[model samples]
Target: MELLPFDEYVRSLDRKRMSAGVLFRDAEGRVLLVEPSYKAQWEIPGGSVDAGESPWAAASREVREELGIERVFTRLLVIDYVPDDGRMPEGIAFVFDGGLITNAEVAALELTDPEIVSAGLFFLDAVPSLKATLAARLAIALRAAQAGEPLLSENGTELT
Candidate 1:
Protein backbone atom coordinates (compact mmCIF):
# COMPACT_ATOMS: atom_id res chain seq x y z
CA MET A 1 0.00 0.00 0.00
CA GLU A 2 1.19 3.53 -0.67
CA LEU A 3 2.09 5.59 2.37
CA LEU A 4 0.43 8.84 3.31
CA PRO A 5 2.34 12.13 3.54
CA PHE A 6 4.16 12.52 6.88
CA ASP A 7 1.97 15.35 8.18
CA GLU A 8 -1.26 13.69 7.14
CA TYR A 9 -0.22 10.40 8.67
CA VAL A 10 0.83 12.09 11.88
CA ARG A 11 -2.47 13.97 12.09
CA SER A 12 -4.44 10.75 11.73
CA LEU A 13 -2.35 8.93 14.28
CA ASP A 14 -2.73 11.79 16.72
CA ARG A 15 -6.48 12.09 16.36
CA LYS A 16 -7.51 10.35 19.52
CA ARG A 17 -11.12 9.24 19.10
CA MET A 18 -14.46 9.06 17.30
CA SER A 19 -17.86 7.34 17.44
CA ALA A 20 -19.32 4.61 15.23
CA GLY A 21 -22.76 3.11 14.82
CA VAL A 22 -23.18 -0.64 14.71
CA LEU A 23 -26.07 -2.42 12.97
CA PHE A 24 -26.22 -6.08 13.53
CA ARG A 25 -29.07 -8.61 13.19
CA ASP A 26 -32.22 -7.12 11.78
CA ALA A 27 -35.41 -7.48 13.85
CA GLU A 28 -35.83 -11.13 12.97
CA GLY A 29 -32.40 -12.25 14.11
CA ARG A 30 -30.77 -12.63 10.71
CA VAL A 31 -27.20 -11.39 10.78
CA LEU A 32 -26.16 -8.76 8.23
CA LEU A 33 -22.54 -8.30 7.33
CA VAL A 34 -21.08 -5.81 4.90
CA GLU A 35 -17.74 -6.02 3.13
CA PRO A 36 -16.95 -2.55 1.92
CA SER A 37 -14.18 -2.61 -0.66
CA TYR A 38 -12.44 0.18 1.19
CA LYS A 39 -12.51 -1.47 4.61
CA ALA A 40 -10.81 -4.77 5.25
CA GLN A 41 -13.21 -6.16 7.78
CA TRP A 42 -16.67 -7.50 7.08
CA GLU A 43 -18.02 -4.84 9.40
CA ILE A 44 -21.33 -4.27 11.04
CA PRO A 45 -23.08 -1.68 8.86
CA GLY A 46 -22.47 1.75 10.37
CA GLY A 47 -19.99 4.59 10.32
CA SER A 48 -18.71 7.67 12.12
CA VAL A 49 -21.23 10.16 13.36
CA ASP A 50 -21.02 13.59 11.83
CA ALA A 51 -20.78 16.66 14.02
CA GLY A 52 -24.14 17.46 15.64
CA GLU A 53 -25.76 14.25 14.46
CA SER A 54 -27.53 12.23 17.12
CA PRO A 55 -26.52 8.60 17.37
CA TRP A 56 -29.94 7.46 16.20
CA ALA A 57 -29.83 9.74 13.18
CA ALA A 58 -26.31 8.75 12.41
CA ALA A 59 -27.24 5.09 12.42
CA SER A 60 -30.15 5.61 10.10
CA ARG A 61 -28.17 7.77 7.72
CA GLU A 62 -25.32 5.31 7.57
CA VAL A 63 -27.68 2.42 6.84
CA ARG A 64 -29.22 4.40 4.02
CA GLU A 65 -25.93 5.44 2.55
CA GLU A 66 -24.12 2.18 2.98
CA LEU A 67 -26.89 -0.38 2.63
CA GLY A 68 -29.46 1.49 0.54
CA ILE A 69 -32.24 0.15 2.72
CA GLU A 70 -34.27 2.46 4.87
CA ARG A 71 -33.48 2.03 8.54
CA VAL A 72 -37.09 2.65 9.47
CA PHE A 73 -36.39 2.67 13.16
CA THR A 74 -33.33 2.81 15.33
CA ARG A 75 -32.60 3.29 19.01
CA LEU A 76 -29.67 3.11 21.35
CA LEU A 77 -28.44 -0.40 22.03
CA VAL A 78 -25.44 0.67 24.06
CA ILE A 79 -22.57 3.11 24.35
CA ASP A 80 -19.24 1.32 24.24
CA TYR A 81 -15.92 3.00 24.87
CA VAL A 82 -12.41 1.64 24.75
CA PRO A 83 -10.76 3.03 27.89
CA ASP A 84 -7.03 2.86 27.32
CA ASP A 85 -7.10 6.15 25.42
CA GLY A 86 -8.02 8.17 28.54
CA ARG A 87 -11.58 8.29 27.17
CA MET A 88 -11.23 11.94 26.10
CA PRO A 89 -11.63 10.78 22.54
CA GLU A 90 -12.43 7.10 22.67
CA GLY A 91 -14.59 5.47 20.07
CA ILE A 92 -18.03 5.60 21.66
CA ALA A 93 -19.59 2.85 19.58
CA PHE A 94 -23.32 3.40 19.56
CA VAL A 95 -25.12 0.22 18.77
CA PHE A 96 -28.45 0.66 16.98
CA ASP A 97 -31.26 -1.83 16.48
CA GLY A 98 -32.56 -1.36 12.98
CA GLY A 99 -35.70 -2.69 11.33
CA LEU A 100 -35.92 -6.10 9.66
CA ILE A 101 -36.16 -5.93 5.92
CA THR A 102 -34.32 -6.81 2.75
CA ASN A 103 -33.47 -4.66 -0.26
CA ALA A 104 -35.51 -6.88 -2.60
CA GLU A 105 -38.29 -4.30 -2.47
CA VAL A 106 -36.42 -1.85 -4.66
CA ALA A 107 -33.66 -3.99 -6.08
CA ALA A 108 -31.04 -6.51 -5.14
CA LEU A 109 -28.61 -5.43 -2.46
CA GLU A 110 -26.64 -2.42 -3.63
CA LEU A 111 -23.51 -0.94 -2.14
CA THR A 112 -23.58 2.82 -1.77
CA ASP A 113 -19.85 2.71 -2.20
CA PRO A 114 -18.65 0.56 -5.07
CA GLU A 115 -15.85 -0.61 -2.92
CA ILE A 116 -18.35 -2.70 -0.97
CA VAL A 117 -17.80 -6.11 -2.51
CA SER A 118 -21.00 -7.70 -1.23
CA ALA A 119 -23.46 -8.21 1.58
CA GLY A 120 -24.68 -11.40 3.14
CA LEU A 121 -27.12 -12.84 5.63
CA PHE A 122 -26.21 -15.68 7.86
CA PHE A 123 -27.97 -17.74 10.49
CA LEU A 124 -27.12 -16.61 13.97
CA ASP A 125 -25.74 -20.01 14.95
CA ALA A 126 -23.58 -19.94 11.84
CA VAL A 127 -22.14 -16.47 12.18
CA PRO A 128 -18.49 -16.41 11.22
CA SER A 129 -15.67 -15.08 13.31
CA LEU A 130 -16.23 -11.38 13.92
CA LYS A 131 -14.16 -8.61 15.42
CA ALA A 132 -14.21 -9.07 19.18
CA THR A 133 -16.10 -5.96 20.21
CA LEU A 134 -18.63 -6.33 17.41
CA ALA A 135 -19.26 -9.97 18.21
CA ALA A 136 -20.04 -9.05 21.80
CA ARG A 137 -22.44 -6.38 20.64
CA LEU A 138 -24.19 -8.84 18.31
CA ALA A 139 -24.65 -11.33 21.06
CA ILE A 140 -26.18 -8.60 23.16
CA ALA A 141 -28.55 -7.54 20.41
CA LEU A 142 -29.66 -11.07 19.66
CA ARG A 143 -30.25 -11.84 23.28
CA ALA A 144 -32.36 -8.73 23.57
CA ALA A 145 -34.46 -9.69 20.56
CA GLN A 146 -35.06 -13.31 21.59
CA ALA A 147 -36.28 -12.03 24.92
CA GLY A 148 -38.52 -9.38 23.37
CA GLU A 149 -36.63 -6.58 25.04
CA PRO A 150 -35.20 -4.06 22.67
CA LEU A 151 -32.82 -2.33 25.03
CA LEU A 152 -32.25 -4.66 27.90
CA SER A 153 -30.72 -8.06 28.39
CA GLU A 154 -32.39 -10.89 30.26
CA ASN A 155 -29.76 -10.67 32.94
CA GLY A 156 -31.11 -7.20 33.74
CA THR A 157 -28.29 -5.49 31.90
CA GLU A 158 -29.61 -2.73 29.68
CA LEU A 159 -28.59 -3.37 26.09
CA THR A 160 -27.20 0.11 25.95
Candidate 2:
Protein backbone atom coordinates (compact mmCIF):
# COMPACT_ATOMS: atom_id res chain seq x y z
CA MET A 1 0.00 0.00 0.00
CA GLU A 2 1.32 3.40 -0.95
CA LEU A 3 1.00 6.37 1.38
CA LEU A 4 0.17 9.33 -0.78
CA PRO A 5 -0.55 12.39 1.32
CA PHE A 6 -4.30 11.96 1.66
CA ASP A 7 -5.02 15.44 2.97
CA GLU A 8 -2.65 16.97 0.49
CA TYR A 9 -4.40 15.12 -2.31
CA VAL A 10 -7.78 16.09 -0.96
CA ARG A 11 -6.84 19.76 -1.08
CA SER A 12 -5.57 19.43 -4.63
CA LEU A 13 -8.87 18.38 -6.04
CA ASP A 14 -11.59 20.72 -7.28
CA ARG A 15 -13.93 17.76 -7.24
CA LYS A 16 -16.84 16.68 -5.12
CA ARG A 17 -15.72 13.90 -2.80
CA MET A 18 -17.59 10.67 -2.25
CA SER A 19 -16.47 7.34 -0.71
CA ALA A 20 -17.04 3.60 -0.84
CA GLY A 21 -16.04 0.78 1.54
CA VAL A 22 -15.53 -2.92 1.02
CA LEU A 23 -16.07 -5.68 3.58
CA PHE A 24 -13.15 -7.98 2.89
CA ARG A 25 -13.21 -11.62 3.87
CA ASP A 26 -10.47 -14.19 3.74
CA ALA A 27 -10.60 -17.69 2.24
CA GLU A 28 -11.68 -18.99 5.64
CA GLY A 29 -14.52 -16.44 5.67
CA ARG A 30 -13.02 -14.35 8.45
CA VAL A 31 -13.44 -10.61 8.05
CA LEU A 32 -10.46 -8.34 7.45
CA LEU A 33 -10.74 -5.10 9.42
CA VAL A 34 -8.57 -2.08 9.88
CA GLU A 35 -7.98 -0.29 13.17
CA PRO A 36 -7.87 3.16 11.64
CA SER A 37 -5.16 5.55 12.60
CA TYR A 38 -7.71 8.38 12.54
CA LYS A 39 -10.96 6.79 13.55
CA ALA A 40 -11.16 5.49 17.11
CA GLN A 41 -13.14 2.53 15.80
CA TRP A 42 -12.36 -0.19 13.29
CA GLU A 43 -13.63 0.14 9.71
CA ILE A 44 -13.53 -1.58 6.35
CA PRO A 45 -11.07 -0.11 3.85
CA GLY A 46 -12.21 2.71 1.51
CA GLY A 47 -12.07 6.43 0.93
CA SER A 48 -13.02 9.39 -1.27
CA VAL A 49 -13.72 9.37 -5.00
CA ASP A 50 -12.20 12.04 -7.14
CA ALA A 51 -14.11 14.02 -9.76
CA GLY A 52 -15.46 12.02 -12.72
CA GLU A 53 -15.09 8.70 -10.93
CA SER A 54 -17.90 6.17 -10.60
CA PRO A 55 -18.56 4.61 -7.21
CA TRP A 56 -17.30 1.22 -8.39
CA ALA A 57 -14.14 2.79 -9.72
CA ALA A 58 -13.77 4.73 -6.52
CA ALA A 59 -14.21 1.62 -4.43
CA SER A 60 -11.41 -0.08 -6.27
CA ARG A 61 -9.23 2.99 -6.17
CA GLU A 62 -9.75 3.62 -2.49
CA VAL A 63 -9.21 0.02 -1.53
CA ARG A 64 -5.90 -0.07 -3.41
CA GLU A 65 -4.82 3.16 -1.77
CA GLU A 66 -5.76 2.16 1.74
CA LEU A 67 -4.85 -1.50 1.66
CA GLY A 68 -1.73 -1.28 -0.55
CA ILE A 69 -2.60 -4.25 -2.72
CA GLU A 70 -5.62 -4.25 -4.98
CA ARG A 71 -7.57 -7.49 -4.94
CA VAL A 72 -11.09 -6.17 -4.64
CA PHE A 73 -13.70 -8.03 -6.63
CA THR A 74 -16.18 -5.46 -5.43
CA ARG A 75 -19.94 -5.44 -5.51
CA LEU A 76 -22.02 -2.49 -4.45
CA LEU A 77 -23.92 -3.17 -1.27
CA VAL A 78 -25.63 0.14 -0.51
CA ILE A 79 -25.59 3.90 -0.48
CA ASP A 80 -25.84 5.86 2.76
CA TYR A 81 -25.73 9.43 3.86
CA VAL A 82 -24.59 11.11 7.06
CA PRO A 83 -25.95 14.60 7.45
CA ASP A 84 -23.92 17.43 8.79
CA ASP A 85 -23.99 18.16 12.51
CA GLY A 86 -23.26 21.86 11.96
CA ARG A 87 -19.59 21.08 12.41
CA MET A 88 -18.79 18.80 9.47
CA PRO A 89 -20.11 18.39 5.97
CA GLU A 90 -22.34 15.47 5.06
CA GLY A 91 -20.92 12.25 3.63
CA ILE A 92 -22.26 9.93 0.95
CA ALA A 93 -21.09 6.36 1.49
CA PHE A 94 -21.14 3.38 -0.81
CA VAL A 95 -20.52 0.03 0.83
CA PHE A 96 -19.46 -3.17 -0.92
CA ASP A 97 -17.98 -6.62 -0.25
CA GLY A 98 -14.71 -8.14 -1.44
CA GLY A 99 -12.60 -11.24 -1.00
CA LEU A 100 -9.10 -10.77 0.46
CA ILE A 101 -6.11 -12.93 -0.27
CA THR A 102 -3.98 -13.53 2.81
CA ASN A 103 -0.73 -13.51 0.85
CA ALA A 104 -1.09 -9.85 -0.08
CA GLU A 105 1.55 -7.49 1.32
CA VAL A 106 -0.66 -5.73 3.86
CA ALA A 107 2.34 -4.54 5.85
CA ALA A 108 3.41 -1.85 3.42
CA LEU A 109 0.87 0.79 4.33
CA GLU A 110 1.35 3.16 7.28
CA LEU A 111 -2.29 3.47 8.39
CA THR A 112 -1.18 6.84 9.68
CA ASP A 113 -4.17 9.12 10.02
CA PRO A 114 -5.19 7.97 13.47
CA GLU A 115 -2.08 6.38 15.01
CA ILE A 116 -1.47 2.95 16.55
CA VAL A 117 -3.01 1.26 13.56
CA SER A 118 -3.30 -2.47 13.17
CA ALA A 119 -5.21 -4.96 11.06
CA GLY A 120 -6.88 -8.16 12.11
CA LEU A 121 -8.98 -11.06 11.00
CA PHE A 122 -12.04 -11.78 13.06
CA PHE A 123 -14.90 -14.24 13.04
CA LEU A 124 -18.49 -13.09 12.68
CA ASP A 125 -18.88 -13.21 16.46
CA ALA A 126 -16.58 -10.22 16.85
CA VAL A 127 -18.83 -7.89 14.81
CA PRO A 128 -20.61 -6.54 17.85
CA SER A 129 -17.78 -4.12 18.59
CA LEU A 130 -18.52 -2.21 15.42
CA LYS A 131 -20.52 1.02 15.51
CA ALA A 132 -24.25 0.41 15.23
CA THR A 133 -24.70 1.89 11.77
CA LEU A 134 -21.71 0.01 10.44
CA ALA A 135 -22.97 -3.17 12.04
CA ALA A 136 -26.33 -2.65 10.38
CA ARG A 137 -24.73 -1.96 7.03
CA LEU A 138 -22.53 -5.01 7.28
CA ALA A 139 -25.46 -7.19 8.32
CA ILE A 140 -27.60 -5.96 5.49
CA ALA A 141 -24.81 -6.40 2.98
CA LEU A 142 -24.01 -9.92 4.10
CA ARG A 143 -27.67 -10.87 4.04
CA ALA A 144 -27.97 -9.57 0.50
CA ALA A 145 -24.82 -11.42 -0.32
CA GLN A 146 -26.42 -14.61 0.97
CA ALA A 147 -29.64 -13.98 -1.00
CA GLY A 148 -31.79 -12.90 1.91
CA GLU A 149 -35.55 -12.89 2.06
CA PRO A 150 -37.38 -10.74 -0.37
CA LEU A 151 -40.81 -9.00 -0.38
CA LEU A 152 -40.82 -8.82 3.38
CA SER A 153 -41.72 -5.75 5.34
CA GLU A 154 -39.75 -4.41 8.28
CA ASN A 155 -41.94 -6.59 10.49
CA GLY A 156 -42.41 -10.32 10.09
CA THR A 157 -45.18 -10.00 7.53
CA GLU A 158 -44.82 -10.27 3.78
CA LEU A 159 -45.51 -7.17 1.72
CA THR A 160 -48.62 -7.13 -0.42
Candidate 3:
Protein backbone atom coordinates (compact mmCIF):
# COMPACT_ATOMS: atom_id res chain seq x y z
CA MET A 1 0.00 0.00 0.00
CA GLU A 2 1.16 3.52 -0.79
CA LEU A 3 2.09 5.58 2.31
CA LEU A 4 -0.14 8.56 2.87
CA PRO A 5 1.21 11.88 4.15
CA PHE A 6 0.87 12.56 7.88
CA ASP A 7 -1.76 15.24 7.39
CA GLU A 8 -3.68 13.03 4.97
CA TYR A 9 -3.58 10.10 7.40
CA VAL A 10 -4.85 12.23 10.27
CA ARG A 11 -7.62 13.65 8.16
CA SER A 12 -8.66 10.21 7.03
CA LEU A 13 -9.51 9.07 10.60
CA ASP A 14 -13.12 9.07 11.68
CA ARG A 15 -14.09 11.59 14.35
CA LYS A 16 -16.67 10.82 17.00
CA ARG A 17 -18.50 13.40 19.06
CA MET A 18 -18.39 13.37 22.85
CA SER A 19 -20.39 14.84 25.72
CA ALA A 20 -20.03 14.92 29.49
CA GLY A 21 -22.49 15.29 32.34
CA VAL A 22 -22.58 15.38 36.12
CA LEU A 23 -24.93 13.41 38.33
CA PHE A 24 -25.88 15.18 41.52
CA ARG A 25 -27.99 13.65 44.22
CA ASP A 26 -29.52 14.77 47.46
CA ALA A 27 -29.36 13.08 50.84
CA GLU A 28 -32.84 11.77 50.26
CA GLY A 29 -31.59 9.96 47.16
CA ARG A 30 -33.28 12.30 44.75
CA VAL A 31 -31.26 13.22 41.69
CA LEU A 32 -30.77 16.68 40.32
CA LEU A 33 -32.25 17.21 36.86
CA VAL A 34 -32.20 20.30 34.75
CA GLU A 35 -34.82 21.43 32.31
CA PRO A 36 -33.39 22.98 29.17
CA SER A 37 -35.16 25.76 27.33
CA TYR A 38 -34.36 24.05 24.03
CA LYS A 39 -35.78 20.67 24.97
CA ALA A 40 -38.87 19.39 26.71
CA GLN A 41 -37.16 16.56 28.53
CA TRP A 42 -35.15 17.10 31.70
CA GLU A 43 -31.46 16.25 31.68
CA ILE A 44 -28.39 16.01 33.89
CA PRO A 45 -26.03 18.96 34.17
CA GLY A 46 -23.71 18.63 31.18
CA GLY A 47 -23.09 19.60 27.59
CA SER A 48 -21.05 18.72 24.55
CA VAL A 49 -17.29 18.40 25.00
CA ASP A 50 -15.58 20.98 22.88
CA ALA A 51 -12.65 20.17 20.64
CA GLY A 52 -9.38 19.61 22.58
CA GLU A 53 -11.22 19.47 25.92
CA SER A 54 -11.15 16.49 28.26
CA PRO A 55 -14.42 14.89 29.35
CA TRP A 56 -13.76 15.67 33.02
CA ALA A 57 -13.05 19.30 32.24
CA ALA A 58 -16.10 19.52 30.04
CA ALA A 59 -18.26 18.11 32.83
CA SER A 60 -16.99 20.63 35.36
CA ARG A 61 -17.39 23.49 32.92
CA GLU A 62 -20.87 22.45 31.97
CA VAL A 63 -21.91 22.23 35.62
CA ARG A 64 -20.60 25.70 36.30
CA GLU A 65 -22.14 27.19 33.20
CA GLU A 66 -25.47 25.46 33.43
CA LEU A 67 -26.06 25.62 37.18
CA GLY A 68 -23.98 28.63 38.06
CA ILE A 69 -22.05 26.68 40.63
CA GLU A 70 -18.50 25.49 41.04
CA ARG A 71 -18.36 21.74 41.63
CA VAL A 72 -15.42 19.40 41.65
CA PHE A 73 -16.19 15.93 40.36
CA THR A 74 -13.60 13.24 41.03
CA ARG A 75 -15.30 9.96 40.19
CA LEU A 76 -16.52 8.75 36.85
CA LEU A 77 -19.83 6.93 37.02
CA VAL A 78 -20.37 5.84 33.48
CA ILE A 79 -19.13 5.92 29.90
CA ASP A 80 -21.96 5.43 27.46
CA TYR A 81 -21.65 4.98 23.71
CA VAL A 82 -24.67 6.27 21.87
CA PRO A 83 -25.28 4.87 18.42
CA ASP A 84 -26.26 7.07 15.51
CA ASP A 85 -29.99 7.29 15.23
CA GLY A 86 -30.31 9.62 12.21
CA ARG A 87 -31.09 12.77 14.15
CA MET A 88 -27.77 12.84 15.97
CA PRO A 89 -24.32 11.49 15.24
CA GLU A 90 -23.02 8.58 17.28
CA GLY A 91 -21.22 9.87 20.34
CA ILE A 92 -19.71 8.93 23.68
CA ALA A 93 -21.14 10.35 26.89
CA PHE A 94 -19.30 10.52 30.20
CA VAL A 95 -21.17 10.83 33.47
CA PHE A 96 -19.35 11.87 36.61
CA ASP A 97 -20.39 11.69 40.22
CA GLY A 98 -21.13 15.12 41.63
CA GLY A 99 -21.45 13.71 45.14
CA LEU A 100 -24.44 14.67 47.31
CA ILE A 101 -25.94 18.11 47.50
CA THR A 102 -27.54 19.25 50.70
CA ASN A 103 -31.07 20.57 50.84
CA ALA A 104 -29.87 24.09 51.46
CA GLU A 105 -27.61 23.92 48.44
CA VAL A 106 -30.42 22.58 46.29
CA ALA A 107 -32.69 25.38 47.47
CA ALA A 108 -30.04 27.96 46.67
CA LEU A 109 -29.49 26.81 43.11
CA GLU A 110 -30.15 29.53 40.58
CA LEU A 111 -29.94 28.85 36.88
CA THR A 112 -28.60 31.88 35.06
CA ASP A 113 -27.94 30.17 31.76
CA PRO A 114 -30.37 30.83 28.95
CA GLU A 115 -30.02 27.22 27.89
CA ILE A 116 -31.28 25.85 31.21
CA VAL A 117 -34.64 26.94 32.54
CA SER A 118 -34.78 25.16 35.88
CA ALA A 119 -33.13 22.54 38.09
CA GLY A 120 -34.75 20.27 40.65
CA LEU A 121 -34.41 17.02 42.53
CA PHE A 122 -36.33 13.91 41.62
CA PHE A 123 -36.49 10.29 42.66
CA LEU A 124 -35.15 7.52 40.47
CA ASP A 125 -38.64 6.58 39.35
CA ALA A 126 -38.78 9.87 37.53
CA VAL A 127 -35.79 8.81 35.47
CA PRO A 128 -38.01 6.74 33.24
CA SER A 129 -39.42 9.90 31.83
CA LEU A 130 -36.09 10.75 30.29
CA LYS A 131 -35.04 9.69 26.81
CA ALA A 132 -34.69 5.94 26.49
CA THR A 133 -30.95 5.83 26.09
CA LEU A 134 -30.36 8.34 28.85
CA ALA A 135 -32.67 6.44 31.12
CA ALA A 136 -30.70 3.28 30.54
CA ARG A 137 -27.32 4.91 30.99
CA LEU A 138 -28.41 6.67 34.14
CA ALA A 139 -29.75 3.47 35.65
CA ILE A 140 -26.39 1.83 35.21
CA ALA A 141 -24.54 4.91 36.38
CA LEU A 142 -26.51 5.07 39.57
CA ARG A 143 -25.86 1.45 40.24
CA ALA A 144 -22.18 1.92 39.62
CA ALA A 145 -22.02 4.91 41.90
CA GLN A 146 -23.81 3.11 44.69
CA ALA A 147 -21.47 0.18 44.22
CA GLY A 148 -18.43 2.46 44.08
CA GLU A 149 -17.51 1.30 40.63
CA PRO A 150 -17.52 2.71 37.10
CA LEU A 151 -19.62 1.20 34.33
CA LEU A 152 -19.73 0.98 30.53
CA SER A 153 -22.84 1.10 28.46
CA GLU A 154 -23.92 1.10 24.84
CA ASN A 155 -27.09 2.87 23.86
CA GLY A 156 -28.04 2.65 27.57
CA THR A 157 -27.53 -1.10 27.93
CA GLU A 158 -24.84 -2.31 30.27
CA LEU A 159 -22.15 -4.42 28.63
CA THR A 160 -20.98 -7.52 30.45
Candidate 2 on 63-110: residue-level lDDT in tens?
666665556544665566655647656666677767554635444555
Worst 10 residues of 1 by lDDT: 151-160
Q: What is candidate 1's CA lDDT for residue 14?
A: 43
TM-score of each: 0.66, 0.62, 0.92
Pick the winner on lDDT between candidates 2 and 3. 3
Q: In model 1, which regions exceed 4 Å deviation?
A: 1-28, 85-89, 102-107, 124-129, 148-160
Candidate 3: where is the Cα deviation over 4 Å? 1-3, 127-129
Q: All predictions: root-mean-square deviation over Cα?
A: 9.6, 11.1, 1.6
Once fitted onto the true fold, the runs of candidate 2 whose alpha carbons sit more than 4 angstroms away are 1-17, 27-29, 71-74, 85-87, 100-116, 124-129, 148-160
Top lDDT hit: 3
lDDT of 1 by residue, 1-160 (tens): 9999999898888432445555555445677877777746666777787877776787777778877867644556655654444534545566676646464532476676775677777554565545655666667766655655555332223343
As for TM-score, the candidate ahead, 1 or 3, is 3
Per-residue C-alpha lDDT of model 3 across residues 39-157, encoded as one tens digit per residue: 88889999999999999999999999998878777799999999899999999999999988887887798878999887888886775357767777778888888999999999999
By lDDT, the candidates rank as 3, 1, 2
Clashes of each: 4, 4, 0
Locate the minimum summed-lDDT window of 10 residues in model 3.
Answer: 124-133
Count steric clashes of candidate 2. Answer: 4
* TM-score of model 2 vs. true structure: 0.62
Candidate 3 clashes between residue pairs 3 or more apart in a chain or in different chains: none
